[model samples]
Target: MNSMKALSVIFIFFLSLVTFSSGDLIEDVCGTSSDFKVCIDALRADPKRCSTDKKGLVRILLQQCSTKANSIYNEVASLLEQAKEHVLIQCLQICKENYDNAIDDATSAIKYFDANDFLAARTSTVAIASAPDTCEETFNEPPVRISPIKSKDDDFMNFIGLTMRDLIEDVCRTSSDFKVCIDALRADPKSSSADKKGLVHILLQQCLAKAKSIYNEIVSLLEQAKEHVLIQCLQVCKENYDSSIDDAETAIKDFDANDFPGAMSAVSDVVSAPDTCEETFNESVKISPIKSKDDDFMNFINLTASLINQFGN
Candidate 1:
């Protein structure tokens, strides 16, 4: 019985040593971050998942970012609904959009991380780091200054930025794709934009380019389709794409002029074009003989529609 008790004590001692060693390693890894305290606190809050490696640290940070983004999105959405001042409403709308984009970007970062594409993950993470700043910048203009909102967002963004900078520095020091990853993140339009309006401009430009590409592809596909029903469906799809392009162009004009609501409304129209095209095919009395091709085209159209919808809300 004494020998067994001795063995149990030894086991407990070794287990404590292992736990202390893990905590020390976590501290060392977090010590390299810009906000070591924040990093340590965050990681310690979920010690089971926070391993001692750099990748583990990044994963935790990304998870935190995703959670914060979702919370901010909900808060901003609620605030927007309650807002009455025209300028405040516009600012809140922009904030809501930024938070939504941040959530999407963080989700993409997680996906890239899961795939071991650190460069892509870094780019998405960096974009998310800029979201709070982009939202706060909307109130920097004349007669719309909201000090409390700006202050809160600024502090939150600083925390996010510090952690991100630490992650980027670690990646540059350790990853073989250091230069490529850093360069890609630095050039990301979402991360580099100076303000909400600038970000909107970039989004609109990308949307317009994508819309044009989809339009061209559909037209080219329509020319090759030999079946009458397939041709008719493709033609309808082409017409929808054409309308989407026009609406996208109008959205760009609205965005450039800082007419955000107008831009959003126009982009919403662009989102609906694909659905209208698909509905046309669905309403046809005769079932499409080229059912497979019809489904393929419709799927493609839906994807394009979904992409455009992101730009608006």
Candidate 2:
């Protein structure tokens, strides 16, 4: 009986030693991060996450990022209600969107990490790291400065970003596609790091580029159909293209000047111009004795309209 009791005490002591060693390992790992104190505290706060491995440490960091991002998102949303100044309200709105994206990316990182897709996990982590900068960039324009809320939120997000970045660096040290994935994401115009206004600008630019392409296509089609009975229909479509191009250009200018409402109105005009052109073509065909259809031009107009509508939304 005494032997059995002594053996049990020895086993317990061994277990205690293992636990302590695990904790020390976690601290040592976290110490390499930018914010070691915060990292250590977060790891210690969740003892269950101390798996004494790099992957486990990354998971813990991602989980903390998700929690912190969600909290910041909620706080920014709540602040929107009390915002009275137009500039401040706009900044908050942008911040809210950025935090929303950060939360989503963090959640995605956790999912990817669970699946052992370290490349995707690191990509998401990099996006989350940029969210705070994207949010803060809105107030960098002249005559509008960062507010107290912005300062606090920036600090909070920086802390989370630094923590996640350290984990991402660890993952990238072994990930073959880490650099490629990161470069692709950064080059993408729809990067999560882009501010709302920047995204809108990109959308507008796309609209303009598409509109110009369609305009050239319409001109070519009109010339080809000049001797055909569909000449009238082509002419009407050409006129619509002219108007659409003009409206899109105006919208781009308005957007550049920060006149959001005006830009939206111009985009609406661009969207409707194509519809009216298509309608006129259909009506002309219906009245004409020649039962002919140009599916190609119709499809082109339809696609352009669809793209414009999507960007407007």
Candidate 3:
């Protein structure tokens, strides 16, 4: 976790929705933000911030907002499935419904923003921004239960207050599974201005995020395992995930240093981490406790490798 966080520190600073003059778009837009330094860092990392116009940047923001809402929706649903308490379940249910609306509103905002309908996009943004409040307030009601998804809620709102990668078309055309390629890019705003090398960079980030998420979950699951088969599967999974994290970070560094083939080779090793993990559970005849996480990571790593395969073709 520390290594992942340390590696991500270089990329974490990004901007949200705002327009500004030509002299310093990142500076001007980020300056308007409530969190100045954080905003500055985000836009600073974007090599295209100065060249990309205001409209393009805002479109990126809206698309990212939509992407994040979908993630939050899925996360809430997962939490809802595990909640045993009546009040907690009820709160999650409310959050689930609200996030569903947020997903639509943020998606709608993208279309409206794209169509030059600023008024409507603003309207949608208003609806998008309300979701966190509604969800957070639901947990604050009498017999209050802490929202299991508070971090997600806060991040969602903060997005409304930071934001997409332009995806699918060209970069995905050569992907083995085109749809999976698109899905892998859903949460990446830098993709809007990224090229082939850049897309690999984004896909590697996606793969790493999924890998890290599943690895953390495995750490927790290991603390509770009683079945021998499950423990054995999880132990193997931990080993796979551990190596995957190292490979992904190495790939990212290679990409940054212009060693494209080296990056590809590293990520090729990465693609097997989830596959091996899943096969362990399958061979042992045990349903993987982290099935969704495994599948999600698999999807990301596959796309990362597939796109890298197409780079020289």
Q: What is the TM-score of each candidate against the true structure?
A: 0.44, 0.43, 0.46
Off by more than 4 A, model 3: 1-168
Report the poorest 10 consecutive residues by lDDT, candidate 1: 3-12
Best by TM-score: 3
Segments of candidate 1 deviating more than 4 angstroms:
1-23, 50-54, 163-313
What shift in Å separates residue 191 of candidate 1 from its native position after superposition? 9.0
The C-alpha local distance difference test score for the whole of candidate 3 amounts to 0.68
Please identify model 2 stretches exceeding 4 Å from their true place.
1-23, 31-35, 50-54, 156-313
* Cα shift from native, residue 44, model 2 (Å): 0.8
lDDT-better candidate, 1 vs 3: 3
User: Could you tell me which 10 consecutive residues in candidate 3 have the lowest summed lDDT?
Assistant: 2-11
**Candidate numbers, best TM-score first, in rank order:** 3, 1, 2
TM-score of 1: 0.44
- Candidates' lDDT values, in order? 0.58, 0.57, 0.68
Q: 59-138, model 3: which lDDT tens digit per residue?
A: 54445556667877898999988889888988889888988998888788778777777656655765665678788888
